[model samples]
Target: SQKIEQNSEALNIQEGKTATLTCNYTNYSPAYLQWYRQDPGRGPVFLLLIRENEKEKRKERLKVTFDTTLKQSLFHITASQPADSATYLCALFSGGYQKVTFGIGTKLQVIP
Candidate 1:
């Protein structure tokens, strides 16, 4: 059984600081991993994707690192602002027609 775990608690941080979040998994052999952001009452939007062979991936103000050996991923948001407040989700794509599974998400709250 594949399982993904993230912080179920909300992260409260001061604006302009970096926010770090962790994602962990069990029993899954994913071909790729993806990160997504979700605002209130809306579906998640894709952020970054890292293949099994890739060590890291990044976008503006965001960086993600994957450690397949440990079955974990870390997400970082630098200079985070109030506008960056949202729930961050981690998903795994296992390939071969298997449906992807997403973590419950960790809510980030950047205080202004």
Candidate 2:
């Protein structure tokens, strides 16, 4: 069976520190990987998308690395702030037409 796991516990951190999160999976031939940010009771907003052929991709203040060999991906937020607190999710596009299955989101809490 295919599965994805992120830290179920909330991450508590001080402002200005880097927040790192992990996504691990097994028994999946994922077509693409995506990351999203979600606030309380809100739908996930897409942040980054990486196809299986890509190794890494980044945006302002955000970086994502995909390692197909290890069946894992790493998401990092640099210079984290209290406003950056939110749940982060990793999803895999599987099956035909890119059906997405999401990992349980990881909550991040940043202190001022």
Candidate 3:
């Protein structure tokens, strides 16, 4: 079975610094990976997506990297502010049927 894992604890960072979050997977080959941000009591909003064949992707202040060989993905937010603080999730399709699996998500808190 395919499984996704993210940091179980919340991360605290000072405002204006770069914040990095990690996602790891096992037992599956994914065609693409996606990142999302979820606020308390709210649904997740899409942030970025990276294809398996792509080494890196970027959008404005956000960046994502996918390393198929390492079975890991890294998400980064530059010049992070309090508004960037949220629970970040990683998701991907697995198996022949393309079932989607999401990581547990890692919470981030940007302090002023």
Candidate 4:
């Protein structure tokens, strides 16, 4: 079955700590994958992306890694704060980016 999935329902982390989220997909050879952060009432905001040729990508406190063999991607946030709490989604673009699929999204709660 071709499906994308996030780690779990919700992730709870303490302030100043690091939060790691996982995204796994099967039976899809996507050219690249993207991550987005979505707030309660707002649309998802682009976070980061990793190409099939790249092993990892990082921006500020956020890091994303792509593993084509395992068909998995990992998202990390360092120095997490309560203000960073949101639902994170992973999208897969395949067939020349014509087809796209999304995970169920994982909610992150950074407790102060």
Question: What are the TM-scores, per candidate, against the unseen true structure?
Answer: 0.96, 0.95, 0.95, 0.96
lDDT per residue, candidate 1, 12-111, as tens digits? 9999999999999999998999999999999999999998898988899999999999999999999999999999999999855378899999999999
Predicted structure 2, TM vs. truth: 0.95
What lDDT, from 0 to 1, does candidate 1 have?
0.94
TM-score of 3: 0.95
What is the alpha-carbon lDDT of model 3 when measured against the actual structure? 0.93
lDDT of 4 at 39: 92
Q: What is the lDDT of residue 97 in candidate 4?
A: 75
Q: Candidate 1 at residue 26, lDDT?
A: 97
Q: At residue 91, what lDDT does model 4 achieve?
A: 97
Please give, for residues 1-112, the per-residue lDDT of candidate 3 as tens digits. 7688899799999999999999999997998999999999999999898989999999999999999999999999999999998999999875553677899999999999
Which has the better TM-score: candidate 1, or candidate 3?
1
For residue 43, model 4's alpha carbon misses the true position, in angstroms, by 1.3
lDDT of 2 by residue, 1-112 (tens): 8899999899998999999999999999888899999999899999999888898899999999989999999999999999999999999997764488999989999999
lDDT ranking of the models? 1, 4, 3, 2
Candidate that would win on lDDT = 1
Q: Write the per-residue lDDT of candidate 4 for residues 8-43, one digit (tens) a residue.
A: 678999999999999999999999999999998998
Q: List the residue pairs that clash in candidate 3.
A: none
Candidate 3 deviant stretches above 4 angstroms: 96-98
Q: Alpha-carbon error at 37 in model 4, in Å?
A: 0.5
